[model samples]
Target: MRTRLAAVAENFGRDLDAAYATIDRLLRRARAEGTGLIALPEACLGGYLSSLGSAEDRGTAETRRQRSGPPALALDGPELRRVQEMARDVVVVLGICEDGGTDRYNTAVALTGDGVLGVHRKVHQPLGENLSYAAGSTFEAFETPVGRIGLQICYDKAFPEAARTAALDGARIIVSISAWPGARTAAAADLAQDRWKKRFDLYDQARALENQVVWVASNQAGTFGSLRFVGSAKVVGPGGDVLADTGVDTGVAAADVDVEAELDAARRAMFNLRDRRPDVYGALVREPAHA
Candidate 1:
C-alpha cells in the first residue's frame, strides 16, 4: 500500500514546553496531510546539549555539570502518554533522552494510540556526545502498520552497519533522526553548499540505496548554541533518489511511496543483501578493540 511519510526539519530549542507544543502542531499538520508516519529531529523532546566546546573545557565532567541534559523520562512516562494521545491515528517516531537506571540514553520511540511499539537507543556518538549519555549496543527493527521499521539517531546514520543490521533484521523502512550541524570551520554561506549538509544528504541516499529501504530522515534546523544545524530533512527512495525534502529550512518533508514496490524493484535487478561477501568481510565481526 502506498502511504504518506513525513520528516520534520524544524528548530527545537531547550524549552521542553515549546517542544511539546511544536510536536503537537507538527503531528496535527501531518495528520491533516494524510501522513501515516512521521519522524522528528533527535533530542526533539528537550534539546541537544549546549555546545561541544573546546577539548580542554569540555568532557564528560563538563557535559554532566554544565549540560543538564534532557528531563530523563522513563519509557512509559506521562510525556509519552501525551504524545501517544496526540498520535491517536498516525504513527510517530520521536527522539528523547531516556532515563535508564543511573544512566540517560539517547533514545527514539515508535508509537501510536496503542502506545509504544519499538524503542531504539542510539549506538554511535560523535564529538563529545559519549560523555553525556550511555551508548546503545544493538540495532533492532520492529513491525509497524507501514512496514518493518528501524530507528537511528544522528551519528548512527554515519555508520553503514547500523542500517545494514536493521535491514538484515527485516527493516523495510528506516527512520533516522538527527541534530546534525554544519562544518565548524569551513561552513558555507549558502546552507545548500555546506559540507556537513552535503554529507547528511549523501548519507541519507546511500543508506536507502545500499539497504534497498525507504529512508525517512529528519533533523534540527537553525542554530542551537554554537552549533548551526543543517536541517536538510528528506525522504529518499530505494534507488537513492530524493522524493521530498525541506531543503535547509524549517518545514516538514513529506512524500508518498509504494514501499513494497520500491523495495522489490530495487532488489530485483541487483540484490545487495543476497550477493553478500560475508566470508571475505570476516573482519567486520571482530572486536573493535582488535581493530
Candidate 2:
C-alpha cells in the first residue's frame, strides 16, 4: 500500500487558538494532497521552552508566576479531541506538554478520527529540559492505518537505542517530532550552515538507515523567544535517502511510499535486524559503573 506521508516545519506559539488555526490549515492541505500520515513539530499545541541552560531562561520570579511554561494539556482534553476531529482519515502525529497531574511530560501522540493510536513521552531530556518535564521509560511500536509506527520527541533521536528498540518491536516507520534549535553559541548566520542543523539532518538519515525503517522528522521553524529553531523537516528512506525535505524553511516535506515494499527491498541485501549479535551487546542494558 503506497501511503502519502508529510512532515512539517513551522512555528507554533503559546496561543491555543492560533495553534488550532495552523493545524486546521495544514490538515486541509494534507487532505487535499491525499496524505495518509502527517507529522507536526514538537509542542505544536502550545509551543516549546522559551529558552534553555540558564537561570534567566526560567525567567524572574514574577515572570515565572505569570507564565512559567507551555500550558499543560491532558491527553483526553478537548485540544486533542479537536485534533482527532481534524485528523479524520489522516494519521496525525504531534507533540504537546502533557499534564501528568503533578508532573508534566513532553509527549508525542499519534491519532486519527477514531481516536488516539499511540503515545510517547520524551525519554531523553536535554539541557534544562529536566527542570520542566519528567522522562519516559520505554520505546514501543503500535499499529496504525498507515503501518506499524513508533513515536519519539526531539533529543531522543541522538540515541541509537531509542530507534533500535522501536524497530526491534516491529515499527516500519518512526515519526520524530522536535522543536530543535540551532547552535546556542557562535551560531551560523545561515541556519543551513548550523552544526546542530547538520546533526538534525544526519540523525534522521542515520536512524532510518541503521534501523531499516522509514523516518519522518518534523521541527519548529523560525525563532521563538530566545531560541532560534532549525527547521529541517524531512522524510528519509530505509536506505538513508532523503525522499523529501523542507530545508531550513517553513513548509511540508511530503512523499509517497509503500512501507512493506521499501523495507523488503532495503533489508534484502543487508539485514541489520536479522544479523544482530545481542549477546555481545549486554552492556547496553547495564548501568554505567561510574554512575
Candidate 3:
C-alpha cells in the first residue's frame, strides 16, 4: 500500500493546550491529504527543557514537585485520550515524559484506533537527563495497518544497534522523536565544536542507505527554556537521498515514502537481511579489536 508520512516540529513549551490544538489541525490536514502516519517531535506531549535553574528561588522545590503531578498525566489519562480523539484516521507517534510507577521515564508512545500499541522508554538518556529519567530495556517493532513501523527517541538514534534491531524485526520505516539541541559556531579559535550533531544529521541518511528503509527524523524547534532544539526535520529514502526537509522552524515536513520501493532497493543492493553472516558475527563480538 502507498504511504504518505509526516514529520512535525512542535516548538512551543509549557503550552499544552496550544500544542494540542496545533496537532489536531495537522492531523486533519494529513488525513485530508491522504497521509497514513504522523510523527511529532520529542517531548511534544508536555514539553522538554526540564530545569529548575536556581535552588534558592522561593517555592522552587514545590513547583518541581507539583510539575511531577497531574499535568504530566499518565499514559491512560486525559492527555492520551485527547490524542486518541484526534487520531481517528491516522496512526500517531509522539514523545512524552512517562510517569512510571516508581520513577519517571522519557518514552515514545504509538497510538491508533486499536489503542496504545506500545511504549518504548528511551534507552540512552543523554547528558543531564539521568537526573530524572530511567532507561528503557525493551526494543521491537509492531505491525501497523500502513506497514511495519519502529520507534526511537533522540539519543537512541545515535546508536546504530537501536535502528538495526528494528530493521531486523521487519520495520520498513524507523520514526525517531528527537529534541536534539541545535549547534552553534565555537567562540574561540582554539576550540572545535563537537561534530556529533552533524554526524546525527548524516547518520539518518546513512541508516536509510544501510538498511534500505525509510528514516524519519522529527526534531523540536525554538527554545523551550534554556535549551534550543534543532528544528531540522527530514525524511530519507533507501538510497540515502533526502526526500523532504524543513529548515529551522516549527512546521510540518512531509513526503511520500514508498515502502515497497525501499524493500525493492534492499533486494537490488544484496546488502539486506538475507546476506548477513550471523555465525561469524558471534566471534567478532567475543574478541576485542585492540589491547
* CA lDDT scores, all candidates in order: 0.89, 0.94, 0.76
TM-score of 3: 0.86
Q: Give the distance in Å from residue 264's predicted Cα in candidate 3 to where it truly belongs.
A: 1.3
Best by TM-score: 2
Residue-wise C-alpha lDDT for candidate 2, range 125-219, written one tens digit per residue: 98878777888999999999998999999999999999999999999999999999999999999999999999999999999999999999999
How many residue pairs clash in all the candidates, one count each? 0, 0, 0
Q: Which run of 10 residues does model 2 get worst, by summed lDDT?
A: 57-66
**Model 1 C-alpha lDDT per residue in residues 1-291, reported as the tens digit of each score:** 789999999888778889889999998888888999999998888888767644533656435634566677788999889899999889999888898877789899999999899999999987777777889998899999888999999899999999999999999999999999998887899988999999999999999999999999999999987889999899999999999999999999999999999999999999999998898997787888855
Candidate 1 lowest-lDDT run of ten: 53-62
TM-score of 1: 0.95
Model 1: per-residue Cα lDDT at residue 34? 91
Error of 3 at 4 (Å): 0.6
**Candidate 1 vs candidate 2: which has greater lDDT?**
2
Give the Å error, residue 246, model 1. 0.5
Q: Best candidate per lDDT, number? A: 2
